[model samples]
Structures are given as structure tokens and as C-alpha cells.
Target chain A: MRNHNVTIGIFIVSGLALFTLVLFTIGNEHKAFSPHVDLHTEFANISGLTKGSDVQVAGFDAGEIADIEVPKSPSGRFRLVLRIDQRLNPLVRTDSLVTVDSEGIVGDKFVQIHGGSANAREAAASTTLPSKEPLSLADLLESSNDLINGANGTMKGVQGKLDGTLDAATKTINNANDLIVGIKQGKGTVGMLLRDQTTATEIQQAVANGEQATVSVKQASASLKHASGQADALVSDFASRGLGGKVDQTLLSARGAAGNLDSISGQLHQTMTEALGEDGRGVDAGGNIQQSLSNLTETTGNMAADTEALKHEFFFKGFFKHRGYYSLADLDPTTYRNDRVFTNPDNGRAWLEAARLFEQTSNGQERLTTEGKLQIEEAIAELGDGALNGPLVIEGYSSQSDSGTQLAASHSRALLVLHYIHARYQVDLRNIGAVALRNTPPPGVHKETWDGVCIMALKASS
Target chain B: MIGIFDFVGAVGLFGLRVIGSVFRIPFELEQIWRHIGEAGVRSLALVLSAGLALGVVMTLHTRGALVMFGATAMIPKLQSLGFFVEIGPLVAALLVAGRVGAGNGAVLADMRATEQIDAIEALSMDSFKFLVVPRVVACVIALPLLTVFMDFCGILGGYLSEYTLSHISLHLYLTRAFQGMQWSNFVPPTLKALVFGFIIGTISCFFGYTTNEGAEGVGRAATSSVVVSSLLIILADVILVKIIFLTFPGSAT
Candidate 1:
């Protein structure tokens, strides 16, 4: 009976002790015995946060949610009554932000109170802290879906433009390619120049004649200056001597010298113009030498274009792609606007209005302002971290009345922005290009015309 | 079917008489204590071992599924919750029903077969109060305490299994295990074992004390005790769980 009593006493005591341990451990986790203060917050969406969910202050477990008051209407927020440990009351402040957070990607939701700034006062009990509405997974997915759909539409448009551009580029390359083949067979003017020794000889003679004419014109100009000086001395001497007949003889000789000098200068001018063409006029008014040289220049230009096309062609592109042999320097406005490099769907662009970006100096020259530089910096930031990795183009636009003024203003704006970016960011000059669009915005840029500069960060095709 | 009803009626009448005798004067405190020692202390090792083994198996089973969800940290919590909320009480009752239920039936049936119960009646002592009330009262008092022991042992067993795999600290495991628990969750399920103990003690004692067939009936009484008590405990558990849920709605969490 004594042994039985001892064993039963031990068993019952141990069982009760274990039960008490469980109760206290659970109570400790919940801060049930700790002194606590109630704080309030309201959220438009609780995001499935239940009453008794864990409440954390700056990621430290504090207490559990005491209660949740449902709103009277859909627009009204759900008021949450949070019970926080009094020891952590100092961390809770009037300016502290409250948000709904979770344990992991798909875990239980909890209330998180971000500590307020040190300058703020400690929050009083039952004070309603500002709450940020939680971002639900459904809302996130919906926004992303809309973004993806917009991106898809933009990509489709870019694809259509790219196809058209590629087709045109292909036709241009083929024609140039045909011309190259013709030249190799000795069919074009360039071929004739290469094959006909007589034409080459004549070009050499014309160049020699031009050189001689230039020398003769220099000699004639020196003689006219000398003759004028002599005439001035003779008139002075005649005035001093009062010799009328001597003045008449000297004047006649000066006239004859002036006539000869004029004749020589005229002949030189005519000969130079006939060989090299007029100052602004092209090969049409020029002699055969000028026309032949023009044809030679055109042929070389076609060859250069063909070589560039070959570098991008499927067969040879692999060689140049990774070697960094690709150049954006020679990109013209037409090609740039059509090329996938600038028009790729992944490219980022920021448009700053001209009025905001530029200020006119006293000399009537427009320059980038301090605010304009800040705006540019913000625009670059908006393009994101990868903005500097690829080719960047500054597209200048102007709404000036005349085409000449528009072109000048647009080009000036683009050049100013380009210089600022290069100096401020130290971006590689080779990786950046500038174009004066002269009032026309790029296709599908959401505007028909814009008086602004568009900074385009063109990502390389994947 | 009529025989089943008759047996149920007899059990109900026997239970009411035991309840009425429980509040009467000259209570069997010594006998209740002795029976508590037999039913609870003697059965402690079996309940604990079974609880520990079940805990190990439950952890191993749930660990794989929880790991796939990247929720392996929930293993300790799941273990404790499972044992406390349902498994500990149910398993403890069934084990007691198997052990003490058979013993109670066989001992009393032997006494009845040999006319010891008749000898007690002849001496002017109430045979039901002397032989049956103490055993039923002991069961009602001891089962819940045994369940508490079972729950803790199960949690410790889970920790052992978890520690081997993760080398988790005991503090962190215990913290996580009890982090989501509440008084309502623990108290209601544990108290429900009282009903289980009553079913086991009453059914077994009824079989033993009411046996009329002499020596041949002892084996039959013992078998019926184990079988009927086990079945009634299971049925009572289902209803008791629902009642607990209704009474304490927060425990559902």
C-alpha cells in the first residue's frame, strides 16, 4: 500500500506538471501574463489576417491581435485592435507604419509595425497608427497581366516595323550587291575608271591643270597688290611735283596692269570652276574629272554599305557579334529609326519637354539648365540600372516653323544633351548616338509630334 | 437487436446506480486510490511507450510532406497539436481499455463465479458499491492525467526524432511546438477523456459484475470487456470531439 501510494503520487504529479508546463509555454509565446497596451490600425483589406494572428514590432514577436472590427460598408476599413507587450511600447510611435506581412511566400499572415523615426513621440495606447494596405497576390497578378499585355502589343508593333525595315534593307543590299557584281565584271563607271587608262590619264591632267591655275591666281593677286601700291606712290609724287602729264602717263600704265591682272584672275576662276564645279553645285556643272570622281565616291559608298550589311548578315554576323566590332557611329537617322537596335521592344525611353530642359542664353543660344541636368539624371534612373549597358541615343525634336530652323534647333538640342550625358556619366561616346528628328516623334511613341528630347536606352537583341 | 437494446439498458441502469452511489456517504476512498494506482500508475509505461512510438511515426510521416511545402518548421507544432487535440486522449483510453478493462472484468467475473460477490452481499455489504464503483471512479479520475502524460511524451518523442535529423535546439523546438496552442485547445480535448474513462470503466465492470455463467463466463467477460469498451470509447470520442468544438469554438483553430 505504501509503494502503491508513492508510484501513484509520482505519476499524478508529473502529469499535472507537464500540463502546467504546456500552459505556461503557450502563455509565454502569446505574452498572456505580460503587461500590454492596445494599439489600433485600419486596413481596407486585411488580406485574410485573422484575429489572434501574431503581431510583430520591427520583426520582433510582440503579441497577438486582440480583436478585429469589421467595417459597416465595403469602402470602410477593417479596424484592428493589436495587443503589444508594454516593454516594446517605446518602439511603437505615432508615425510608425503598419503593414500586413507573412511568414514566408505562402505562410500565415501577421501584422507588422515598422518602427517610427527617432524624432517621433511614442504612440499612446489605442492610437491609430497609419496602415499601408497589403498587396494581395491577385492584385499583383492582375497588374502584371496588364503590363504584359501592353508589352505584347508594343512588341507586335515593333515586330511589324522591324520586318518592313529589314525588307527594305534587304532590297537595298541586293541592289548594291548587284552593282558590286557589275563593277567586278567591268560594267559601271567605277569599272570603266579602273579599266580605261585614257580616262585615268585625263583625270591626272585635269588635276595638274587645276594646280597650275591655283598658282597663277596667287601670282595675279600679288601683282595687283603691288600695282595698287605703285599707283598710290605715283599720285603722291605727282601731287608733290604738280606734273599733270606725268600723272596721266602713270595712270595709263596702272590701268593696263590692272586689266591684265583682272584677265588672269578671270581665266583662273573659270578654269577652276570648270574642273571642280561651282561652290555649292555638284557634279552636274563640273568637268569630266569632277563627274568621274563623284562616280568613284558613290561606288565606294555602296561598297561600304554592302560590307556593313554583310557584317550583320546571318552567315558573317556571328564573327562580329561577340568581338564588339559593331559600330553605331555611322547610323543615319533613317536607318536608326528603322533599325531594331533603337526600335527594340525592350528599349527604355524618357521624354523631357524642351521648355523644361533648355534655357536661352543672352546670345540667343539654348543650353541645358541645372534643372535640365537633374531631369536628365532622373530620366536615366527611370530607365533602370541596365540603361548604361547598351547603345543610348538622344533623339532631338523641335517644333520650329521652318525646316531649316527646326533641323538646327533639334540638332543643337541633341548635341547639348549628348555632351552633358557623356561628361556627367562618362558614357562611352561610341555607344551613344544623337539624331535630330526635326519635330517628328518615333512611330508608336504615343505622340504625333513633340517639342522635346527623347533619351532612348537601346538594349541589345537577345 | 432486442438483446443489444437490453444490454444497453442494463449498462445505463448500472451507470445510474454507480453515479448515485458516488455521492452517498461512506465513500470508498481507499479502494478508489488502489484502483487509481492499478489503472493509472501500472499502465503509465505502456501509455508513454505507445505515445512515444506514435509520435516518432507521425513526425517521420509528416516531415516528408511538410518538407515538400518548405514548411518543415511546422513539424513540431503539428506533432503537439495532433497528440493533444485528438491522438493522446483517444490512444490512452484505448490502451487502458485493453489492459485495465480486461483485468477488471476477469477479476470480478472470477469473484462472481466463485460466489465471493454473494458472500459480500450476505455480509450486508453493497456488492456494486464495493466491487464496481471504485474502479469506475478511478478510471474517470486517472484517464485525463494519463492523457496529459501521453501528450508530453509524444511531444518529447517527436523532438528526439526531429533532433536526429535537424540538430534543432530543445528550446526552439518546444517554443515552436507550443507557439500556436491555446488553453481552449488543450483543456477541452483533455477533459473529453473523462467521458472515455467512464465508458471503459462502466462497460468493463458491467460485463464482469453481471456475469451469471460461473467458471465458463470469466473468459467471455474479459473478452467482451476489451471489445465493448474499445468500441464505445471510439464512438464516444467522435461525439465528444464535436461537443468540444461546439462549446469552445476557438479550439478549432
Candidate 2:
């Protein structure tokens, strides 16, 4: 009987103990036995956060949400009561931000409390913390979709403008190229002056006539000087001879010769001035030769302006872009450095050092030496026989202390190299261009600064 | 149908008499203690074994489903919640009805068939108090305690099964198991076992005490006790669970 009682007692006690253990463990999870404080926060959207969802304080597991109060109106926010452990109370300051967060992409939602700054006071019980409503996935995706659509629209518009600009540029270059080719073929008046044998002979003959006229004028001036000397001698002789008849005749002859010489000299001076402008008044001041040359220059400039205007015209825009030609003069240093034509991976480059390639003239101007011409020929040869098929750009670089000096030096070097290449090799002028890049070389050239020209030949990928 | 109603009416009258006799008597402490040992201590092994077996089976079943959702971590919680809220109390009651209820009925019916109750009544003792009331009270006191044991044992069984599969630590398993639990989830279901205990005790005792047959009736009484008590417990469970949910709505979670 005692044994039976003991077994029953043990059974009852153990069962009750297990029950107590379960209750205590659950109570601990709920913070029922621990000292805690309640905090309040309101949100426009709870985002599936339920009561008893874990509350983390600055990423630390602190407590859980105790209650949620639904608002009476649709516009009103849901008020939440958070029960946080007293040990973490100091971390819950008045300025702490409360937000609803999820455990994972598809996991349960929880309340996240951000720790406030040290300057903020500890939040008292029932104090409402600042809240930010949870952002829904739908809203985020919608906003991103709108942003992508807007960006796509902007890119389309920009692409359209760029295509139009490129087309116009290509058309202008092709037209300019055609015009130059026409002139080279002697198809027009300017072409005739440059290429016609008859016109050339006439120009040579006119030059000879001007030379002869100058020599005649010089002879007239010499005669006048000689006449002045003779008058002085005649006056002396007249005084000595006491106004004899022979002295009077000699004076009249000298006077007649002096007057005739003066007339000849005045006519020569007027003829010279009309043909070859006035002395020290500049070539454009007044003269038939100066005026004709000025008119030609003006006409060429107008033609160039009209060609340049084709780049902006709607009709020729697409044609220009298709040709892929760009004006070297229009490219600044930055643009040249970034331009794909000269920076192409397939393009071959030859670096000619300024000191090796050029020498200073007696007048302090830089010009390419004989060795420089040889170096350019060798660089072109290194690019293979196919170098002449595509465009070649002469990239001029000069490391001068001043920007203006750098630009001038680099431009002079590039122009000299360009002229030498054209004149020496008979290379098509339309196939080559020169650009002054100041001190900076194009990207991928492995140089921080350069003081020379780089002959870049666009080579087709083989 | 008429016979079924007549049987029910007789059982109701017998239950009323038992209730009245329970208050009117000199308290049957010794008998209650002896019956408690018989009903609770002796039944402990069966309850634990069944609890453990059920736990393992439940875990095995739920593990597959939870794994499909990538929620295998919720297996322990599901096991605990399953045992605490419904399985532990109901299964324990049914087991007790089959074991203790049959034992109580058979024992009482043997004494009645052998004229032991008539001998006790001739000596100026209340036979119902000396016999039926003690057995009923013992059941009432023992059932909830058995339920607690079943609940914990089932959880231990689940942990063992889970540990074999996952090599999960005991502390972590226990923590996760109780993480989603609430006081209402546990207390109300455990307390509902009291109603199940009452039904088991009263029906078993009524069947055993009212039996008029001889030795053959003892077997009939035992069989009737188990069937009636188990059925009543199940029926009572449905009502009690509803009442619990109505009283403590949070337990539904």
C-alpha cells in the first residue's frame, strides 16, 4: 500500500512539474515574468505584422509586439503597443524610428526599432516613437517600372537627336569632299587657275610684266637723282661764265630733261601703285591683284559657311551621319581624346618626338626636319600598304608651360607634318586630318604628357 | 430506440444518486486513494507509450508537409501545438477510458455479481459512496495529470524523432517547440481534460453499478463502460473545445 501511494505521488508530482515547466517557458517567451515597458507607435500600414511578432531593437532581439489597435476610420493609422524588456529600455529612446520589417522575402513580418542618438532621452512607458510605414513590394516595383520607362523615353529622344546630328555631319563632310575632288579635277574656274596650263602661263606672264615695270620705275628714279646733280653743277658754271649764251642753253636743256624725268617717274609710280598696292599700306589697302585675291578668299569663305550650314539642315542630316566624317578643325583636345576614330583599337600609331622630328628656324619658327619626313614615311610603312585606304589623323601634342603656347606649337607641328605627308607622298588630302591636342595624348596611349605628333592610321580589322 | 432511451434514463438516475451520495457520506478518502493509484499510477506506462508512439507518428507525417514549404523548422512547433491543443488530452482520455474505465466497471460489476455491495449495505454503509463515488472522484483527479504526462511525453518523442533526422540540439528543439505556444494553447486544453475525465468516470460507474446480470454481465459491463465512456468523452471534447475557444479566443492561434 505504501509503494502504491509513492508511485501515485511520483506520477502526480512529475506531471505537475512538467506542466509548470511548460507554462514557465512560454511565460518567459512572452516576457510575462520579466520587468518590461510598453511603447507606442502608429503606422498607416502594418504590412501583415501581427500581435506577438518579434520586436528587434537596433537588430537585437529585445521583445515582442503586445497589442495592435485598429483605427475606427479608413484614413486613420493602426496604433501598436510594444512590450520591450527593461534591460533594453535605455536603447528605446523617444526619437527612435519604428518600422515594420520582414524576416525574409516570404517570411513573417516583425517590428524593427532603430536606436536613437545618444543625445535623445530614454523613452518613457507608453511614449509613441516616430514611425515609417512599411513599403509594399508592389509600390517599389511600380516606382522602378516608372523610372525605367522614363529613362527609356529620355534615351530614345537623345538617340534620335544624336542620329540626326551625326547624319548632318556626314553629309556636310561628303559634300565638302566632293567639292574638293571637283576642284582637284579642274572642273571649275578655281580649278583652272590651279590646274590649266594656259591659265598658269598667263599668270607667269603677268608676273614678268610687273617685274619689268618695277625695273623701269627704278631707272626713272635714278635719272631724277642724276638731273638734280646736273642742275647744281649748271648753276655753278653759270655764275663762273657771267651769264654766257652757252650757259643759258645748258640750263634750258637741263630744265627740260628734269621736267621730262619728273613726268616719267610720276606715271611709273601711279602705274605701280595700281598694279601692286601702295608701299607700307598693306597688300589689301588698294590694288587690282589684292582686290581679286580678297574676292576669291571671300567667296571661298562663303562656300565653306554654306557647307557648314548643311550640318544643321534637316535634309542633309542623315546623309552626313552615314558617311561618318568629322571636321578635324571642329575637334577640341577633349573631343579628340575621346573620339573613337583616332582611339580605335585597330588604329596604328607612330610617336614622333618633337626634338627628333623638328628644328627651329632662324626666325624662331618650328619646321619638320628631313629626318622627320623619313620618320613619317617609316611610320606609314609600318602600318602596312593598306594604311592609305582609311582616314589618318595627325595628333599633335606639345608640352609647353603655357596653354596658348602649347596650342600654337602643337598646331604648327601638326600642320607641318600634315603638309609634308601630303606634298611628299602625294596622299589624298581628303584621307588625312590634323588636330592639335595640346599636351595630352589620346587615352590608351600610355603617356601622361606628349611633346610630339602621333600618326594614327585607321586600319580595318583583319 | 425505446430501449436506448430507457437505458439512458436509468444511467441518468444512477448518476444523480451517485452525485448525491458523494456529498452525503463520510468522505471515502482511503477508497479514493486506492482508486487513484489503480487509475493513475498503473495506467502511466500505457499512457506514456501511446503518447510517445503518437508523437513520433505525428512528427513523421508533419515533417514531409512542412518540408514541402521549406518550413521544416516549424516541425517542432507543430508537434508541440498538436499535442497540447488536442491530441494529448483527447488521446489520453480515450486511453484511460479503454484502460481505467473498463477496469473500474469490471471490478465494480464483479463485486455486485458476487453480492459484495449488498453485504456492505447490510452493515449500514452507503455502497455507492464506498464504491462508485471513489472511482468517479479518482478518475476526475487522475485524468488531467495523465494528460500533462501525455503532452510532455509526446513532445519528448517528437524531439527524439526530430533529433535523429536533423541532429538538432535539445535546447534549440525545446525553444522552437515552445516559441509559438501560448498559455491559452496549453491551459484550456489541459483543463478541458477535466470534462473528459468526468464523462469517463460517470458513464463507466453508471454502467457498472446499474448492471443486474450475473458473471456474464461483468464482461458486458466492462465492454459497455469502455464504449459509452469513450463515445461520451469524444462528444464532450467537441463541446469543451468549443467552450474553450469561446472563452479564450487567443488559443485558436
Candidate 3:
């Protein structure tokens, strides 16, 4: 019986001890026996932060939220009372930033305390730390939506500009089509320059004439220069032989004759001025006859003296007499004399006559006739010459429709011509190119009257 | 209808009579100690086994559910909360009602059938005081201690199970287990265990003390004690939990 009592007492004591251990562990978690400092902070939106939520210092758990109160002084904010470990109180400074944080995207909320600088004063017990509200998922989503909307608007603006550019490009392509048609039909100056043999011949003749005129001017300038040199030598010889006086006498006689002639000319000018009298204004509007007669006689005398000095000084005479190479005669303005035309073989290779090669329809649908094959074969053989040996460009034409359907139909027609030529001549396929021109036909021909692929040969541009 | 009223009256009188005899002089300390040994010491191994089994089962079940929420790491905390607030006390009480209540009912019913209780009464002794009072007092005292033992064993069992699967150390598991617990979580349920002990003792003693049909009545008494005590304990728990929540709002969460 005593043993039974002892065993029972042992069990009871053990049970009590176990109970105390559990209670103590629970108390430790609650900080019931630990020395702690109470700190306070205010947040506008704690975001469901509750009492007993962890208070962390620099990501390490230092304490827990002890209480949460809504003071009447601040309407929207809740003041959180934090119980921090007393040992960590020195690390918590006045300038430390406190923020409400969540463990993960959807995890429990906690209060995070970022330590202040070393020089900052320690925050006293019950001091309120500054707090920043935690970011909410809704706010993040709204900002992301704004960014996406901005990017979407920018992309839409770029698409609008791209559409505008495409429209302009289409217009430019249509203008090019019109220009190609005009060239094919020999309708404009470019066409005339290409297809009109007479104009080409005239251009060649003009170029030849310019070359001949250049040669003639060169010869004439040379002759004049040689003649001037001879004159200079003769004058120098006369001066060196002391025969300058005789030459001067001769020039004096010439100058006297010129002076008499100048006086007579002045009298003739007076007679004319008197016949055409200025009655309305009573002014000599035509001439001052007596001053003119005296001035002419003095100029003739000065010229006679100057010429006598020039005869004595041959260097001045030679300088005055030398003529330059360029002259009015050098320009052959009427027509060039040389008629040798340098015709580019490549120029004649464009726009072959395909009347026999394709049957024309008023609706602008072209098909190869039986005779058309023969004509194509002949044209191919002709183009086989070394001068025109290059790519055979078949430009198909469609008018009245700019739709892709018409464009595709024109392409089919050009492809038919390309295949026909390829099969018959065994020509290298690389030397053939096909194209479709929409809303255009050979220039100067109406859409109702024209239908054919203009078989033009391409020669590499030099 | 008369039997129903008689049964209710008898149960009410039995409860009142037990209360009246609680503070009588010349207390039966020796008998009380013996009953305590019988109720608490003899039943300790059973309680420990039940608690450990329940803890391991609960840990595995909670892990199954909590894993879906990616909260498998909260197993220790969840187990602590479950055992302290609801499982530990109730389980320990039910276990006590089965072992102690049946033992007391069967022994007292056998004594009455053989006229042992009457023999004591004829000697001018308080038979209810001698037999029922000590047993009731012993149950009341031992239940809380047993509940604490159950709690300790349960937490240890949960830690073992969690450690097996998650490899968490004993220290870490204990820390995590008790971190969310408060005094209120531990107190209210333990106090409610006292009420459970009282219910089991009084109900079983009432059935056992009134035995009249002879040997067959002993079996009925033992069976009835277990059934009645278990039902009443559950019903009382519902009310006690409500009161506890109202009294300590934090523990209610």
C-alpha cells in the first residue's frame, strides 16, 4: 500500500512538472517573462495587421505587436504598440523607419523596423516611429495597367503612321507606272529620244559639228598667234634698224587723213541733228556739233601720235595685237557639220513590236496567237545578238482596275509569255523578268483599245 | 412517465447529496488517496497511449489538408492549437470516463448487490461519504493532471511524427508549436476538464449507487455509466466551449 502511494505521488508530481513545462514554453513565446521595451508607431492603413504580429528588426524577429489602438486624435490611422526585446532597444533609433510588411505575396503581415544611422539618437520607450504603408496588390495592378495602356497607345500611333506611309508608297508606285507606260508608248520626250531615229541622228550630227568647230577654233587661234608673233618681230626689226622715223612719217600721214575724215563725219552728224530739229523742248537733244568736231580732231591727232610711239615700241604693239583662241566663229550655232551618230545599241533594245506576238482585246486581255509564237521566236533570235543579249523584260498591262485580282491576272499573262519564250528558245531563265503594271497601259493608247505585254529587252547599264 | 420523473429526481438528489457531503468533517483521506491512485496512476499509460495516437493521426491529417495551401510547415502549431483547445481535454476526459467511471460503477454496484454498502451503513457510517465522495473527489483532482500529461504526450507525439517526415529538430518543432499559443488557449479547456471530471464521477456514482436488480444490474450499471458519462460530457462541452469563447474572445479565434 505504501509503495502504491509512492507511485501515485510520483505520477502526480510528474504530471504537474509536465504541465509547468508546457506553460513555460507558451509563456516564453508570449514574452511573458522577458524584459521588453514598448514602442509605438502609426500607420494610415495597416492592411489587416493584428495584435501579436511579429515585429522584426533588420529582418530578424525581435518582438511582437502587443496592442493596437485607434486614437481619436488621428481618424484614419491605427497606433501599434510593439514589445521589443530590451537588449535591442539601443539599435532602435529615433530616425529608424518602420513599415508594415507581408511575409510573401499572400502570407501573414508583419512590422519591419529598419535601423537608423549609427550617429542617430536612441529612440526612448513609447516613442512613435515613422511608418510607411505596405504596397497592395490592387495598387500594383493599377500602375501596371497604366503602363500597358501607354505602350498600347504608342503602338497604335506607330501603326497609324505606318498606314500613312503605305498609302504614300502606293501613290508613288502608281506615278512610276504612268511614267513607264509613257516610255513604252513613245509618248513623251524620253520616248521620242529612245524611239525616234531621226532625233537620235540629229543629236549625233550636233555632237560631231561641235567637235569640228572646236578643231577649227584651235587652228584659227594658232594662225592668229603665229601672225602676231611675226608682226612683233617685223616691228622690232624696224625699230632696231632706226627705220622707226619713216614708219612714224607714214603713220602721221595716215593720222592726218583720219583727222580730215573725222571732221567730215562730225559735219555729217550735225546735218543729221539739224534735220531732226528738237522744236518742242528747244534743246539740242541729238548732238553738240561744234564740241564734237573739236574733240574728234584732237582724238585723231592723239591716235596718230600714239600709233607712231607704238611703231617705235614693238612690245606694246604685240601685246595689243595678240588674239585669244575663243571667238564667235568657234560656236557652230546653226548646225554641226559632222554627221557621225554614236547610237547606243542598248537604247534600241526597249519596247519590241508585239502586235503579231499577242492577240489584242479591247477589254485589255492579251493571249498568244499561233502567229504570235513565231513572232516571239523571231524576236528572241534577234535579241540573241551580242549587242542586245540581256534579260527579256515582259511588262504586262492592266487598266481600269487597281485591285490585286487585276494585278494577279496581269502577272499570269506575263508569266505565260515568259514560259513560252523559255520553252521554245532554251534561253537561260535568269535572263527573263516579268512584271505587272496595274491601272496603266502603253502610253497614248486608251485602255479600251490596247492589250499586250510590251516585250522589252533589258541591257545592263554601263 | 412516472419512471422518467423518478429517474430525473434520483439523478438531481444524487448530485445534490454529493455536493452536500463534499465538505463533511473527518474526511476519508486514505480512501481519497486510494481512489486517486486508481483513477490517475492506474490510467496514466492508457491516457498517454490515446494522446500520442491522436496526436500522430491529427498531424498526418492536418498535413494532408494544409499541404494544399502550402502551409505544411504550420503542422506543429496547428497540432498544438487543436490539442490544447479541443482534442486534449476531451480525449483525456472520455478516456477517464471509460476506465475510471466503469471501474467505479462496477465496483460499487457489486458492493451494493452483495449488501457491502448496507453493511457499512448499519455500522452508523456515512456510506456515500466513504465510497462516492472520495471517488468523485479523486476524479475531479486527477482529470486536470491527466489532461496536462495528455497535452505533453500529444505535443511530443506530434513532434515525433513531424520530425519523421520533415526532419525538423525537436527544439524547432516545440518552438513553432507553442509560438501562437496564449494562456487563454491553455486555461479555458483545462478548466472545462474539471467539469468533465465532475460529470463522469457524479453520473457514474448515481448509476452505481442505485443498483437493485442483483448481479445483472452490475453489468448494466457499468455500461450505463460509460454511456451516460460520455453523452453528458459531450453535451456539457458544447455549453462550456460557448461560455469559454464568450469569456475569452481571443481564444475563440
lDDT of each: 0.88, 0.86, 0.78
**Model 2 segments more than 4 A misplaced:** A44-54, A67-75, A101-110, A134-462, B7-25
Cα error of candidate 3 at position A298, Å: 62
Predicted candidate 2 versus true structure: per-residue lDDT over B1-253, tens digit per residue: 9999998898778878767877875889899888888889888999999999999999988898888878877888889999999999999999999999898788888888999989999999988888888888888889999999999889999999998999999999998888757788999999888877777888888777878699898999999999999998888888888888788766754
How would you encode candidate 2's per-residue C-alpha lDDT over A384-460 as one tens digit per residue? Answer: 78787767789888999999999999988988998877765567878888989898888877778899999888766
lDDT (Cα, 0-100) at B116 in candidate 3: 97
Per-residue C-alpha lDDT of model 3 across residues B1-253, encoded as one tens digit per residue: 9997998788889988887898986589998899889999998999999999888888888887777878766788889888888888999999999999998899899999999999999999999999999999889889988998888788888988888988999888887788657778888898788898888889889888989779999999999999989988999999999999888776765
Q: Considering TM-score, which of the candidate structures 1 and 2 is the better prediction for this target?
A: 1
Q: Evaluate fnat for each of the predicted models and list the values in order.
A: 0.57, 0.65, 0.65
For model 3, residues A1-462, the per-residue Cα lDDT tens digits are: 889999989988997887788788777776768999999999888887777777888877778889999867756678899998888898899889999887654356789999988998998999999888888889999999999999999999999999999998997897687668756766445765666899989989999999999999999899999999999999899889999788889999999999999999999999987877865666464455666888999999999898768755768755533421112122221221121111223432333334555665678667676566656657665655742355565656544354786676666666777777665444576666566654354333323323446565544442
Best candidate, TM-score: 3
Residue B109 of candidate 1: its Cα lDDT?
93
- CAPRI tier for the interface of model 1: acceptable
Model 2 chain A poorest ten-residue lDDT run: A277-286
Question: How high is the lDDT of residue B233 in model 2?
Answer: 85
Cand. 3 Cα-lDDT: 0.78
lDDT of 2 at A236: 88
Residue pairs clashing, model 1: none
How much is B55 displaced in model 3, in angstroms? Answer: 2.2
